[model samples]
Target: MLGAHDSTRDAGRAQRWAARLAWPLLGIVISLGLWALAARYISDVEVIRAAFAPQAGLKALVHLLGSGELWPHISTSLQRIAIALLLAMAIGVPLGLCLGLSPLFARISGPTFQFLRMVSPLSWMPLAVMALGVGEAPVVFLLSFATVWPIMLNTAAGVAALDPAWMRLAQSLSATRWETIARVVLPGCISHILTGFRLAVGIGWIVLVPAEMLGVSSGMGYFVLDTRDRLAYDELMAGIVVIGGLGFALDWLARTISSRWTQRGKQG
Candidate 1:
């Protein structure tokens, strides 16, 4: 009976894993099929063909890899993203903690924050270029601007939602304010903070491409423009593929990190 139960459990686990893997595989297959159909039925224009043709795109990607030109673009983009995300976290987390802990602060700043958040980050591109000059700074600023809101708002919400009993318990134990915040408040809101970080990273990654277009000499965005100017549609498609793949990978990584943090938080 014990052996039979163990076998049943193993089978169930295997089935769950298979099911989890199947969905993504199916989606990829469907997407490839659609691309193939589009390549065949779409206009015979070279640009269109290059964009849709998997073979052409793959060839272009191979050429890019061989030329060693792609790495610089990718590196520049990633660097900008990393810097912007770090800046956003530095600014947003502390502000969020303050707003979350103090009702008066939240009330005073919340409306202004909402208004600022409502302003599209892309709308600031022209101003950013004019003020900061056209280069990596503008791109990093834009990405950070776009991403900071999620982290700030989520952190504030998390703090607000923390159990009141924890605060009371800390007070009863004569804990210092800093001690309470560090020991009681931060741990309670950690899951929410992780959630916010994941969201912020996703937003930052998505915005980085367009942000990179602000006259940067090298980045995936510039590569796209360069390919278009050179009429290398295949290369353009390859750049797009690289951008999408990188974005997906970043989001996946953020989610994985968030999951690990959540598990640790729960265990603690």
Candidate 2:
């Protein structure tokens, strides 16, 4: 009986994986077909043959990868995102905690925060460049600014929603303020923080592509521009694919981390 049950479970798992894989493959095929159809209408024979064909894009991807020309751009973009995310967390968490803990502060600053958050990150690029001078500094600033709102708002909401009973219990235990915040508050709010971080990462990454196009050199965004200027549409498409792949991987990592954290929280 046990062996039969194990076999059934294994089969189910295999089926689920197959289904997951199949849908994406189906989508890719449909997309390629559409591209091919569109390519037929293009006036430029070379552009149609090279840029719009899936095989051409794949070849370009392979060539770029084999040549290792995309590595520096990838690394630079990754580093910028890492630094910007860390900066957002450092600034956002404390602000969120404060807003969460204090009703007066929340009321006072909430409108202002919402207003600032509504402004597009791109609008600030010119100002950032003027103030910071053209380099990674402005990119970091724009990304950090763009990403901070989600983290801050999520953190604040989590803190605000924490159980009053938890606070009472900590008070009864005579926990120090710092002790309560470190042990009780932070742990209780971690799931929310992680949720915020996930959102911040996604937002930051999307913004990072454009942010990289700023005065700084060597990033996926810069590569895209370079390819465009050089009229390498196939290579440009390849870069887009690389960006999408990296973004997907980052989101998957975040989801995995969030899931594990939730499971651990439940277990504890």
Candidate 3:
């Protein structure tokens, strides 16, 4: 009976995996078919074909990979993103904890945060350039600024939602302020923090494309513009594909980390 149950579970898992992958594959096939049809029938097929044809774009992507021309752009973009995320986490987590712990502070600063957060990151481009100058600094600043809000808000909510009994228990045990926070608050709110981090990564990556277009010479965004200027439409499309694929990979990694943390919390 146990063996039969195990077999059934394995079969169910396999079925789920099949469905998960099958739908995306089907969608890709349908989309590629439509793309090819458009390339075949469009009035300006010659002009559009280089950009629209998946084969051409794939060929360009392969060429770029083989030639090693894309590595610098990829490295620069990834480096900026990593640094921005780390900066956001460093500022946001501490600020969030403070806001969560102190109602008075939250009341004082909440409106200001809301106002600042409402402003689009792009709107600050001129100011960032003027202040930070034409370089990686402004791009990193924009990415960090855009990502910080989600992490901060989610962390604050998580801290607020932690069980009051945990705090009381810590107090009863004569735990120090730091001890209570380190032991009770941080652990209890880790799931929320991870969720926030996942969300921030997605938002940050989306912002990063435009952020890179700002005065920086080497990044995916610059590559896109460079390809366009050089009339390498296929390479432009290939660069776009590279950006999308990298963003998807980053999001997947963030999701995996969040899932693992959630499962660990459940087990604990």
Candidate 4:
């Protein structure tokens, strides 16, 4: 009976894995089919041709792989993104914690935060350029600005969702305010905080490309502009593909890490 049950469970797991893999594979097949059909039927003047031409884009990707120039641009963009993400976490998490823990503070600052958050990050580009000058700083600032809200909001939500029983028990044990927070609040909220970080990284990555275009000479954004200037549509498309792949990879990595951490926390 046990052996048969084990076999059944294994078959179920295998089926699930197959199903998960099939969807993405099917999506890719469908996308490629659509691309081929569009390429065949669409007018040459359409952007779709330049965007999806495999031969041209593949060649451009190969050229980029061979050249040292591509690496530098990728590195610079990644560096700026990393810095901005770190800065956003540093600022957002503490503010979020405070707002979550103290009702008075939340009420005082909520309106101001909402107002700032509602304003589009792009709208600040001109001001960022004027105030910070045309450089990586402005780009990083804009990326960080775009990212901060998600982390902040998530952190606050995490804190708010903490079990009140834990706090009550800690107080009953005569725990000091700091001791209770350190022992109870942080650990309870950590999973949510990590979720926030994953979200923030995604937002930062999305903003980084456009923010890099704000006048930085090096980075994927500049590469895109350069490709356009030279009428290298294939290279432009290739750069865009690279950006998207990298962003997806980054988000996947972060989520994997977060899941592992959550699992560990549960086990402990």
Question: Which pairs in model 1 have colliding backbones?
Answer: none
Q: Tell me which residue pairs clash in candidate 4.
A: none
Ranking by TM-score: 2, 3, 1, 4
Candidate 3 residue-wise lDDT, 1-268, digit = tens: 9999999999999999999999999998998788778767755657776565889888899999999999999999999999999999999998899889999999999999999999999889999999999999999999999999998998999999999999999999999999988999988898888889999999998999888889989999899889989988789878988999999999999999999888887887
Worst 10 residues of 3 by lDDT: 42-51
Q: With candidate 4 superimposed using the best TM-score fit, by how many Å does residue 180's alpha carbon deviate from the native? A: 2.8
Judge candidate 3 at residue 119 and give its lDDT.
95
Clashing pairs in 3: none
CA deviation > 4 Å runs, candidate 4 = 1-20, 40-52
What residue runs in model 1 are displaced by over 4 Å at the alpha carbon?
Answer: 1-19, 40-47
Which candidate, 1 or 4, has the higher TM-score?
Answer: 1
Can you write out model 4's per-residue Cα lDDT over 83-185, one digit (the tens) per residue? 9889988999888889999999999999999999999898899999999998878998999999899889888998899999998999899999889878888
Candidate 2 lDDT (Cα, 0 to 1): 0.90
Off by over 4 Å in 2: 1-12, 42-49
lDDT of 4: 0.87
* Model 1, span 126-162: residue lDDT tens: 9999999987788988999998998888888889999
